[model samples]
Target chain A: MKIRPINHKKPSKIRELTYELKVEQVMCDDVITLSPDDTMNDVLRILRDNKIRGILVLDKDRLVGVVSIEDLISCLVDKGKLNEKIENRMTKDIVTVYSDESIVQVVNKFEDNGYGRFPVIDRDTKKLVGILTKGDIIDGLLEKLEIEYRQEEIHRYRASHIFEDVISDNSTLIMQYHIKGGDFKKAGEQTSKLRKNLLRLGIMPETIRRVAIASFEAEMNTVIYTPEGELIAKIQPDKITINTIDSGPGIPNIKQAMRQGYSTAPDWVRELGFGAGMGLPNIKNCSDEMKIKSKVGKGTDLQFIIYRRENET
Target chain B: MKLSRIIQILDAKILCNVQGRLDSDIPMICGSDLMSDVLAFIKSGALLLTGLTTIQVVYTAENAGVNVVCFVRGKKPSKETVDLANEKKITLLTTNMSMFESCGKLYNNGLIGGSDYEN
Candidate 1:
C-alpha cells in the first residue's frame, strides 16, 4: 500500500465562506431567558420544555448571568435548592458574542473558552438578542456550503450545455438520477451510467471499479428502503464524489445497519437477493471517505468521496 | 487459478460469454449467499460462489470487486441478473454441485479462501 501525505496546508473553502457571515444571520433570535430572581424550578421547566442546555438570565432588560443545566443539576444534588433564586447559583462570568461580530470571531471565542453556547447581544443596547451554539454554527456553515455548491452546479450545467467541447479538461462533471422504491428492474442503472461517464473521462480502471461498486450499493440502498431518492455524482480533477439523499423512513440505527449481515429488509426484498445488510459496508469499503446523516422519520443523506490515483491521466 | 481452469474443475455452465481478458488470473475464491458477508470478506479479482440468484448478487459481486460469480446447486439467475452481469462485465456460471461440495472441490483444486483464516 502506498502512503499518501496529508495535505494540511490547504484551507477549506467552507471555513473561508463562513468567516464572512455575521452572527446575526445564524443565531437563534428567539431567545429563551430567565429573570435573575426566577426560582430554580423555572429554569428546570424551561430547559426541559424547550430542550435547551442553558437559559440566558436577564435583569431589567440587561443581560446578566446564564444558567445551564449543569448548574441546576449540581445545585439540585449538592443543596437540593429547587426554590432558590437563580442569581445566587447562576454563572456570572459569561462570555458573549455581539450580533454584528463575524462568525469567525464567535468561533475563536468558542475555541478559546470551550463554551458550548454564547449569548448574542446587540452592540448598542447590550440586550440579549439571541443565543448561538456550536450546533448552530455548524448548521450555518453547512447551509452556506450547500448554497455555494448548488450555485456552482448551476453554472457548470449552463456552461456544459451552452459551450459543449469548450468545457476544459479540468472542469468537473456532475450527473444526477432519481431512484424509486421497489424498483428492482432498474436497479444498478445509475451506477452503470456513472461507470460509462467515468470511463469516458479516462479514469483508471481500478478507480472506476471502486466508484461503480460504491455508487451501485448506494443506489440499491435507496431503491430497497426509501420511497424515493436522488443520487448525485460529481467528477472532479482529483476525486469523485457521490451523494445519495432519500425521503422518508430513514435508518434508525446507522451503527447496526453498518454491521455485517445485519438486515432489516423484509423477507420479500431478501428473496430478491438484496437486504443482506452489507450495502453500507460495501460503500464504505470502496470509498476513501463516507458520511451518513439520517433522521428516524425524516430522511437520510449519504456522501462519499473517492480520490483519483496518481498514475491516472 | 484461471477462470477457464475453474470452469473445467467445477464442470460449470457458462451462462454468458466469458469474453475479454480471459487469461486474467483469479487470486482466491469466496462462497456465500449472504451479500453482507461477501462484501465484508471479498478481495479484488476473487471468484464468488453462491446459490443466490438475484440481481443483488451480481451487484454485490461487482461492488465487492469480485470479477466472477458461479451459482451452486443448479441455481439459475433471472434474466435481469444475467443482463446486469453482462452490463458490468462480470463472468457468470452455474453448477449442479452443492455449496459444500463445490467449495471442497475448489479447495482441493488449490483455490484458497480469500480471507485470512489463520488469524
Candidate 2:
C-alpha cells in the first residue's frame, strides 16, 4: 500500500458555481434530438456517432420521450426489431428542467433520479431548448471559474467579501440547511457543504472534522427521529456552533439519550449500520459544549459548539 | 498506499470509471459498516472498507472526505449509490474478501489505519 499526503487546499469555486449558474448557461443547446417517428436504428446511429448515452424524442418541437443506451441494449437483448419506432421503446415519463432554474436544483434532480441527462425546456414556450448532463455542469463550472480567474480583481473581491462581511467584531457567518425526515439519500449533504465552507475559510482540519462529525450525528438524529428539521451553524472566529431544530417527537429522557448505546431508531435504520444508540454520545464526545432541549410530542433542539483552539485538541 | 496496489492486494474490482484516481496514494484505511463511527474517526482522503453497500455510504464518504470506498464481501451498491459516488468523485471498488480479510491484507501491505494516522 502506498500512502499519499492529503491536499487540504482544494478549489472552492465549484460550490459557488452551482449556486450562481443556471441550467441554460450550462446546458448543451445543440441537442441531438430525434423525432418519435424515428426508428431505433436512427437512435443507434446517432448515439454511436455522437458518443452520447441518450437522445430526446421530440414531436414537432415538443419533447415526448427519451431513449437511452439501456433501452437500446434491452431492445437488442429482447430480440426486438431495429426498425421499430423509437416512441415504442422511449420512456415517456421524462423529468425535465427549466432553462432558468439554478444548477443546484438540476444537481438534486440528477442525484434523486440517477439519470445521466435531463432535457432542458424553455419556461415560456415549454419547448426543449437544450440538454444537461453531469459533465456539462462540471465543464460549465470550470469554464466559468477560468473566466473568473482571468478577472482576478473580481474574483478576489467575491471570495474575500464573504469573510469580510462576517469576520468583524461579534459578527458570525450563519449557514442554514434543511433536513427532510426519511430522506436517507439526502442526509449528510449539509455536513458536506459545511465541511467545504470551513475548508475554504481555512479552518483547522482537526477542528473542522470535529465540527462535521458532531453536526453529522445531529443531522442523522434529525433524519431518523423527525419529519423535518433544520441545521443552523454559526461560525465565529473562535468557535463554531451548531443547532439542529426539529418539530417531531422529542426525546423523552435527555439523560438516557445522552448515554452510549441508547437509541430508539427503527430496525430499518439499524440495518443501514446506524441507530447503534451512539449518535448523541458521539456528538457529545466531539464537541466541547453540548445541550439539548426537548418536550415530548413537541420537538427537539440540539446544540453543540466546538471551539477553534489549537491548545484544546 | 497507492490505490492501484491496494486494489491488487484485495483483489478488488473497480466499480466506477474515474480515470487518473487509482494511481494516487491512499494515506490511511478505516473499515466500518457504521457510518457514524466512520465519521467519528475517518481522516481526509482515507480509503473506507465496508460490507455495507448503500447510497448512505456514499453520502457518508462525501461528508467525511473519504475519497475511496471498497465494499468487502462481494457487496455491490445500487445504481444510485454508484452514480452518487461518481458525481462526488469518490472511487468505488468491490472485493470478494470479507471486511477482516481486506483489512488484514491492506495492513500487511503497509497501509495504516486512520486511528494511528496523525498530521
Candidate 3:
C-alpha cells in the first residue's frame, strides 16, 4: 500500500460504538402500521398523527410493504383518490435490517439503499419487531456515550483518592491477583491495575514504568508457562517488591530461560506478539534485584524489587 | 511533537478514537516488534511504532503507559486488536512506510527515540 499523504480520518468513537450496540437497542418498537386494506387517506392521517416520514404496511403481524412521504405526494400529484388501497401505492421491494445486527451494518444499509427508515426484524423469529430511524440511532448513541463519560469521571475520581488518612509507624500496601494460564486476554491486567494504583499514590513516572514492565513480563510468563499462578506485590516506603508463584510444570533450566532470545513458548503464543525469548531478560533489566527458584515437575517462585529512589533517572 | 504533525510527517492513518486530544505533544518514540523490548524501554506518554498487531501489543502499550501506537509497514490489526485499543482509549494508527523510514522522518522532525533514555 502506498502512503496516502495527510488525508486520513481517525475512526470516530461513535462509529465504534455502533459495533457494540444492536439495532433493537436503538429502534422504536411502538410501530404504527397501515394494513393492506387501509386507504391513502388513512396513511395521510397516520403520517400526520405520528409525524413519521415512512410507514410500514402490515398484513396482520407480517410486514408486506412500505409507504413513504413521496408516495403520498405522488398520489396528490396525480390527483389520485385518497380512498385508494395502501398496498397498491406502497413500495413492495422494501429493505430491512435484523434487530440483533450491529448498528454499523444498519448504517451501511442506510448508505447503500438511501432509505429513510428500516423495519427491525427479529433474526431468530424473522418477525417484524420495530422500526428504526436515523434520529433514534443518534439519540441512542449519545445517551450511551454520556453514561460512559459519567462512569469514567467517577472512576478517575475514585482512582485519585488512593489512600485515606490513617495513623501508622509503617504502612505497606499489599495487592494480590491470580493469573490464569492460557488467558492471553487478561495476562497484563494485574500489572496495569498496579500501574494505575502507583500513579494514584503519586509515585515517580519512571519508577512506576520500571515496576510495571518487570511485573507485566513476570505475569505473562506465568500465564504462558504455567496452568495458573498468583502475583503478589508489596509496596514499601522505600521500594516495591513483586513475587510470582506458579504451581505448574516448572522450568528445568533457569539459566537458559534467563538468556535473551531463549524461549520455550509454543508457536501460537509467539504469534501473539510474545515468546520472543526476552521476558526474563527484560524482567532482569528493569528490576534492581531479582531471583528465581524452581523444581522440576513442581512449581516456581520469582521475585524482583525496584527501589523508590528520587532523581534516579 | 504534536501527534497530528507526526501523522502528517509519516502519512499515517489513525485506526481508532483517542481518549485525549490529538494535538497533544509526545516526548519520544520507540520502534520494536518485540513487546518485551517495548515494555522495558518505553517511557510514559511516548508513541510506539511496531509491526506486531496482536492483542498483546495493546496490552504492552497499556502496561507501559504508551498512549499512541502506530503499526508500521502497512500492518493493520484485526478487529479484536482494534476493539481492545478503543476500549483502552489508546490511539491506533497505520502507515505504508517501513519502520526505518518512519523513524527517520520522525527523527528529522525532532522526535527522539527510546535510545536517548537508555542508560
Residue pairs whose backbone atoms clash in candidate 2? A1-B1, A2-B1, A2-B2, A3-B1
Alpha carbon deviation, residue A171, candidate 2 (Å): 1.1
lDDT of 3: 0.85
The per-model lDDT (C-alpha) reads 0.81, 0.84, 0.85
Candidate 1: share of reference interface contacts reproduced: 0.43
Cand. 3 TM to true fold: 0.64
- Pitting candidate 2 against candidate 3, the one with the higher DockQ is 3
The lowest-lDDT stretch of 10 consecutive residues in candidate 2 chain A is A1-10
Residue B49 deviation, candidate 3, in Å? 7.0
What is the C-alpha lDDT profile of model 2 across A1-313, one tens digit per residue?
Answer: 1111112223335544665689999899998989999999998999999999999998986789989999999999999999999989999999999999988678778877777789999999988899998889878888998887777656445643565565556768889999999888887788878877777666777898788788888888898889999999998777999999999999898999888788788899988878988899889988999999999999999999999887421
Which docking category, incorrect, acceptable, medium or high, applies to candidate 3? Answer: acceptable
Which parts of model 2 have CA positions greater than 4 angstroms off? A1-160, A165-168, A310-313
Compared with the true structure, the alpha-carbon lDDT of candidate 2 equals 0.84
Docking class of 1: incorrect
Per-residue lDDT tens digits of candidate 1, residues A1-313?
1111212222446445454678998999998888999999999999999999999998988887989998899998897779999998899999999999977677767767766789998999877889999788778877888897897676555543532454675767779988887788788777777776666566777888788878887888898888999999987778899999999598888899888678888997777656877778888988899999999899999999999866664
Error of 1 at A19 (Å): 63
Residue range B13-108, candidate 3, lDDT tens digits: 989864344767888899988788788778888899999888888889988888899999999999988988887778999999999999999999
lDDT over C-alpha atoms for residue A278 of model 1: 76
Best model per lDDT: 3
User: True interface contacts reproduced by each model, as a fraction?
Assistant: 0.43, 0.55, 0.68
Q: What DockQ does each prediction reach against the true complex? A: 0.16, 0.29, 0.36
